[model samples]
Target: ELKVEQNPLFLSMQEGKNYTIYCNYSTTSDRLYWYRQDPGKSLESLFVLLSNGAVKQEGRLMASLDTKARLSTLHITAAVHDLSATYFCAVDQETSGSRLTFGEGTQLTVNP
Candidate 1:
């Protein structure tokens, strides 16, 4: 079974502050993904980590994965009010077909 855990389930920071959300999985996974969801909105894909040491960045957000450690991280640089949303990390197990196990989302609130 694959289990995922995310820390700091709720985060409150000022605009321009930086923070990192971590995801740890109990079993091996080949693919990892980061997603964002606004209140009353569907999830939006943020990043995809396909291999070990994979890293992707867009705007003020960066995501990295370490397959060996079964860990993934989403780093937010200079957070803004617009970036306030629920962030999630999901792991894809090959044996599970297209099914993905998601971590408990982190609800971020960026204040002025």
Candidate 2:
């Protein structure tokens, strides 16, 4: 079985500060994804790490994957209030038949 775990389930930080969210999986995975969800809205795809050592960045968020270590990281740089949201990391297991295992999600709050 594959399981994903994310640290700092809840986070509070001031605007302009930086933080990193970590995701660790129990098994090896070639694909990993980062997603963002607002209070009541659906999840929005932020980054996709398709291979080992893959990294992706957009705006103030960056994501990276290391298949060998079975870990992925989401880094937030100079966080803003608008960037406050629940972030989740998902891992794709080939044996799962298109099912992706998701982490519990990290709720981030940015205060000015």
Q: Which candidate ranks first by lDDT, i.e. highest?
A: 1
lDDT of 2 by residue, 1-112 (tens): 8989999899999999999999999997878989999999999999889998898989999899889889899999999999989999999888657778999999999999
**TM accuracy, model 1:** 0.97
Q: Would you list the clashing residue pairs of candidate 1? A: none
lDDT, candidate 2, residue 26?
A: 98
The lDDT of model 1 is 0.94
Candidate 1, residue 20: lDDT: 96
Q: What is candidate 1's lDDT per residue for 13-50, written digit by digit as tens? A: 99999999999999988899999999999999999899
RMSD of each: 0.9, 1.0
lDDT score at residue 93, model 2, on the 0-100 scale: 86
Model 2 spans > 4 angstroms off: none
